[model samples]
Target: MEQTEDEGYHKLDHQLCFPLYAASRLVTKCYQPVLDELGLTYPQYLVLMVLWESDAVNLSRLSERLKLQSNTLTPLLKRMEELGLLTRQRSKQDERSIIIALTEKGKSLKSEVPRLQQQLMDIGISKEEAIQLKGLLTKMINYISG
Candidate 1:
């Protein structure tokens, strides 16, 4: 009934979550310099990317898309608004909902994204591997979220 030391349950490597957490942080760190040039934090960059794709989206829809709660998104949106990167307006059809639209400034940042994506791609992940990794990660996320 004895378990080997390698089977130790408390080790950091034994936790499935640890690698995911560490990798997320490291990958984000690699993005810091490029993000700094755009004057955006990682989360803010994510928000901008989403808005660039679906401008004039409502708060709840945006929250769903980003997997963020409305409270968490509100403050970030406020900061982006103050930076003149976006505008927040009450939805005419539903006063209870807020619509988010990127300002010209925010839309302009989209042009920089291709360069950022290219830089990351150059960091050694092959196209096939990148596709596979994305598929695996998306599957894990869907399973976990479900």
Candidate 2:
């Protein structure tokens, strides 16, 4: 009996993208409890991380940095603002431009990041392995983006 070309190759586990997608979802799931303590969702946490690095950035700049669209980000930003975590206001220099700035509450969340990171790292990957994985993923991202 001859095996068809599709027989072995069609398995989901054999696909490169499947593991990456699964890992991404699993990692995000692990983050849920940690983020919940701070009343944040994963995307909201990511937005806060960017703002923590640069306190005030225009919407376009933020959207570019986060690799998200304004339409998607706008609703997230509005929710964050409503939560008293951050604020969005029109830039004085350009009325058309909107600036996003972290509030005191937002700034306070930076202290919790280390704990969240540690919790994720507890999944058994060593520091060196984590760094290497991050580097590989970043390379893949850059290549695909290019």
Candidate 3:
């Protein structure tokens, strides 16, 4: 049998991964302006979301949840602390670990996030579409991670 040179080679247009990567980057860029107004970066916004859901998470746990390394998270957390958005204190029970807690300012920002996120949703996707998109993303991530 004759074989084409293209067999087993990669093609950008046909790759599902590229769309996921591109969409992720674009979505992060879209969030940048909204987050900037709150004095936050996309990663910081992610941290805020995690902390908003549960306020006093340990450093390691936050890093794991956010898929960040301790070195990277440490600086980000420090910056958040300097911005008066959150507080970092060494755990009294285990001095080796640190606890990150949202400050009043950070807690107050939660109300504004819904409005900002809604704006993105309204412009980028409908509510029903967004739910379906979320499910699709979850499935993709789970499959890739698995």
- Root-mean-square deviation of each candidate, in angstroms? 2.8, 3.5, 3.5
Over 1-146, each residue of candidate 3 has an lDDT whose tens digit, in order, gives 24355763365776677888998898788787778787788888888899999877999999878777999998888998999999999999999989999999888888878766754764566789888988998887778656
Model 2, poorest ten-residue lDDT window?
1-10
| Model 2: how far residue 121 lies from native, Å | 1.9
Segments of candidate 1 deviating more than 4 angstroms: 1-6
Residue pairs clashing in model 1 are none
Between candidates 1 and 2, the one scoring higher on lDDT is 2
Give the Cα-based TM-score of candidate 3 against the true structure. 0.84
For all candidates in order, the CA lDDT equals 0.87, 0.89, 0.83
lDDT minimum window of 10 residues, candidate 3: 1-10
Summarize candidate 2's per-residue lDDT along 57-130 as a digit string, tens digits: 99999888777899999999999999999999999999999999999999999999987886687766888998
How close is every model to the real structure, measured as TM-score?
0.90, 0.89, 0.84
Better lDDT candidate (2, 3): 2
